[model samples]
Target: MREDAPVWELEAATFDADHTQALAARLGEQLQAGDLLVLSGELGAGKTTFTQGLGTGMGVREGIISPTFVLVRIHPNLPDGPRSGGPDLVHVDAYRLGSAAEIDDIDLENTMDSSVTVVEWGEDRVEHLSDSRLEIALVRSEGAAVTPAGDFHHNDPKDAGGRDGVITDFDEDDDNEERLIRITAYGERWAGRKPDLSVD
Candidate 1:
């Protein structure tokens, strides 16, 4: 079997959704047009949350949501932002796509050169679209409970309350769940310009 290609990797620990987004935002500042980001992770792993940060950092219009049903959503850069002359943000959810041909059908190449395309659940399926891409994987840290995407739910009421029947704010405790994020850069585009993941 062929070994995996050499890659630039960075491991980060993020607490809560906001922290994950902040990290992504820092990374987004380093991105430019024609960039492809492949995000791989399980459900409720903060994939969309990260994209939200990227959009914000890119100075795209607000309201960045998961394009689960629509399959793809485009957010244009602000007219006067730093990315004004750069590409737009193309957020894609490939969870429903069955093959790479289906991704090709989207004709992403049309905007590939002028946009930062981010594909969720697009690990093996979308690599063919670009020779160089950034691959990000988010995983829940050990002992951390999984939180729903975009929304939070309380844990067991019993756990939140003592025998005296006092209600506690689960959000405080739940927000501490840390996520292990791995970023890998592939191909020549990232040869000398690997993202600086040192930022907290």
Candidate 2:
């Protein structure tokens, strides 16, 4: 609940979108309903790509897309499908949310207990939604900056409201950027448990 909260963290690097998705899929297998995943990353850090993998592992229905403009997207569990018993995926984009009060305005507590909630760009906004949560940060490695060199990000839209966070300022046409992801487990929900991050 505090900044010095009970926590344990691990670091893993992903070389591509596939690796990011694979890593998240592994975690998805271990998660259950009422779990919260907080994702932090600059634009183009594969947040959506990672969430897609999570949905796949959780056995949710397809069509996992960025909820930036839509704000929230719920991918329900697939009936009679693989991982059909898994929980639904509730993806929330908090990039435009300016405060905790705003996050509460959406009434997340209503569905969090029955769904796997993942919040993108929710570094400090949605931590209180649960007693324990998985805080994941995806960082672009050096030489892999989101903004290409010599390109000033004047009037960056992230500062503006109502964005989906799927667009990037950098060109990935020939660039293969690696992302460093750090996952931290907090509260009693994850106590004494170490995730087996065996992503192949």
Candidate 3:
């Protein structure tokens, strides 16, 4: 089904973590169940910060930390929140997963229809998860890197075959940092639909 869907992309520049989150919130308002977001970027590039914004836009419960230790965390939508109604947020960390098989081992399909799944460090390993998905890559400005919430020096992102940054926890305390966020939608699920990513 994705083969017929034309791939389209949107790019934006953010001056701080909150700015990045605000943009993600706009995109998050457009997402629903069966949606998948695969994040890719270097360390401290604001992946976690972006997810936090999605939670806000989706009206999910607060405290959306990175799934570093637990590997997976679910944030259910709130009845009294901003959006009022939406699917839960399924946050996943694919850093330790070396292959697609490992990704399947987590059994995400159980909630695939009930939640919006987001995976960090899933650049090359999440194509099979869904026929249609949103692939987001964050490029941080040089000399503006912030410290990741988790200690993730396992492998240098610059030398890891150009895969992506390691999975780390959410960091909301980072100083002003510029990030170029590119969002690409694939598969027929997004056919004829253009999302509004404009945010203040």
N/CA/C clash count, model 3: 1
Off by over 4 Å in 2: 1-6, 143-176
Predicted model with the maximum lDDT: 3
Candidate 3 ranges beyond 4 A from true positions: 1-6, 143-175
lDDT of 2 by residue, 58-155 (tens): 88888898899978899999987678778899999999999888999999889999999999998889988998898877766655334222221223
lDDT of 1 by residue, 1-107 (tens): 11235345555677678888887887788888999999977777778888998987788878998899999899999999866765689999999999999999988
Pairs in clash, predicted candidate 3:
2-187
Q: lDDT of model 2 at residue 139?
A: 63
lDDT of 3 at 71: 88
Question: Can you rank all candidates by lDDT, best first?
Answer: 3, 2, 1
User: What TM-score against the true fold does each predicted structure earn?
Assistant: 0.80, 0.82, 0.81
lDDT of 1: 0.75
For each candidate, what is the lDDT? 0.75, 0.77, 0.77
Q: Can you write out model 3's per-residue Cα lDDT over 63-181, one digit (the tens) per residue? A: 98879888899999999888777899999999888999988999999988889999999987878889889888887655545432221122222232432452334354553576767
